[model samples]
Target chain A: MKWIDAPWIELLRIALEVAATVAFALSGVMMAARKRFDAVGVCVVAFVSAFGGGTLRDLLLDQRPFFWVRHTEFVWGILLLSLAAMLFMRQRHFQPTERAMLLPDAIGLGLFAAVGVDIATAVGMPALIAVMMGVTTGVFGGVLRDVLCNEVPQAFSDHRPYALCAFAGGWADVALRQVEGTVVSPLLACVLITAGLRGLALWRNWELPAWRV
Target chain B: MKWIDAPWIELLRIALEVAATVAFALSGVMMAARKRFDAVGVCVVAFVSAFGGGTLRDLLLDQRPFFWVRHTEFVWGILLLSLAAMLFMRQRHFQPTERAMLLPDAIGLGLFAAVGVDIATAVGMPALIAVMMGVTTGVFGGVLRDVLCNEVPQAFSDHRPYALCAFAGGWADVALRQVEGTVVSPLLACVLITAGLRGLALWRNWELPAWRV
Candidate 1:
């Protein structure tokens, strides 16, 4: 309720939330299509991937009436997107290239990381926990998506710096918490850092060393 | 707090919760061993399998300090069990048969379904939603486990009567809500119905027909 009521800030938050949702939804849809899942499976997977992380974060914060439930428009947006995407892909026989997915996915991860940090901080979570929550928010959706698609989560196994990027951005958000009214918004700064790191990682083929036993 | 304060009933609930946790943890350990996961991976997978469903439920209900966080004993139980099981498995080179997993998994499913229904009802959820939540609690851990282990969810693909059994049992729990002073405890009745149906289904090799799209 309070979240839905915060005027201009709330409007900006909603916009970011939509962006994050669309990014994740696109990722989910692409995966589902790759798996050749039916239309129903595509929509379900897309919804879960788009909404799962924020839902988990909200529930952890004990926020009632989930974000999607509160803003049915988000749900509608995903549904419409999935429908359109599915139809377009079916008609055009187009497969989304991995490179096509990279930009939105990176942007979504950054937006979600910032949003997660902001929400957790608003709920008075400890700074470290808030940062962790931010990473969870950014990465967990993809984890759910990958899991549902019967793959080891890219976050856990691919050794890419996905979660690490979010982690760094979260720490940045926390460090810049005191610097209000700067030239760039701290939230925007967090987003930029995360997206930049993820993009750079992709470009440079950066990876965390895999642990083997 | 109220859940932990219901005296005798709470004690029974706690016992059931422990039983379910151990059952699920064992299944997780068995799955991890089958995958030949390292100790850390084993423990992480086991924890998620054992706690994921209830954690999801608590978050949805806006219950804070998640069930595992509040009942640290459950967390300890899972950790210790995972460790012991891993050591025993490694030393003996033992792989648990699917049959070994069947009984406990079924029992845990039933118990968790009842607990889910009870919690949802207590929170004043609609009967249908509560029943759905019950099935979710009963099946989602295994879903998470299967997904993490890079397999399609047995509930979705096995076409088995697993979740359907839980759904039926949950509906029974809801239906019997008005029946007070019954010979059978409603909770126990729900458990028996779910476990019985699941057992029979397994014994008879019953499955839902796969829908082709």
Candidate 2:
């Protein structure tokens, strides 16, 4: 908590949040484009992807004035990003692909997980619940994007270790928090471990065990 | 707000809410069964359908201790209902069908819409936003159910006027609130109008114009 009071740390947190939001928004934009959605639909998808996870976490935690609402600039930023993405893709004749979204999606997942865990822990939520919130924050946005696109959530069905990475990262955060006087920021540790694990999973093509039923 | 303070009104409201929740949960149970989901999946879907819309509304309004959390009985009730449903369906050799879900879904929509509007208005939200909350509460649970089942939400993709019924009902509630010394309960009016409209739509096979693009 004291670490968060440092101006530089607060700035870093905001910067990471913005980066994660943009990454998630881009993934939504790509999904919408692939689905042949119109302009408004594309923007809606982007907004949902950017805000859905944190919104859900806030709701569960009973927080007021949602993160996006408190920071209206996020709304404007996503809008401009969505518009730019559409125009840029059209001009370049870019074919949006799932593979193109992987990196950004992974990065967003890690950052969001870190933020979600931090917020939940700040509110005195138990470690298990905090970890779940982290996983929810990291994975729910993409799940929503896929759902809106009328597909089973890739996080649930793709057999890729998406949420599991967030789960591990959340635990890493809890472990770090328990250690006294560690210079390593728990948030940074979470993001690195999560994104790195996800990267390796993709590189090695790891898969979770699918339900047999 | 004074009207809501009446003990009888409070009792009636709780009764309607319980009915609505069960109806929504039943619809979810049927859908999950149709999809051949396991017991855990069926219960999850039922819980989501029963609480998803209200949860979203609570989040939007920044309400604490979500409806389901505040009323632990609702959670237990849904758990029992889900188990009972699976057993009964199996014993009866009953095939779960979309048609079987219509009546319960419509009733749930009407009741949830009324409750959502009441809650929003109680919080001093503007009429338009309150009405939107009503529509959201009526429609979002089913949307989430469909999404979890990996289909486009029928509320959006189906040609039927589902949310439109809630929209009209919301406006009716708004209009009634403006009337001086009305004997009729606005909640009852909203429910009757919404459910009646939905029933008519189903009977007449009414369709909304599809997007051509």
lDDT leader: 2
Per-residue lDDT for B68-113 in model 1, tens only? 8888988888889999998887799787898899999999999999
DockQ of candidate 1 against the true complex: 0.14
| TM-score to native of every candidate shown | 0.61, 0.61
For candidate 2, the docking band is incorrect
Q: For model 2 chain A, where is the 10-residue window of minimal lDDT? A: A204-213
lDDT agreement of model 1 with the native: 0.82
Mind listing the fnat for each candidate? 0.19, 0.19
TM-score for the B chain of model 1: 0.93
Question: Model 1: how far is B164 from its true place, Å?
Answer: 6.1
lDDT tens digits by residue: candidate 2, A150-205: 87666755657788889899999988888945324788889999999999999999
For candidate 2, the TM-score is 0.61
Clashing residue pairs, candidate 1?
A: none
| Model 1: residues with Cα > 4 Å off, grouped in runs | A1-5, A32-48, A55-97, A124-133, A144-213, B1-52, B55-110, B124-132, B144-153, B156-213
* lDDT of each candidate versus the true structure: 0.82, 0.85
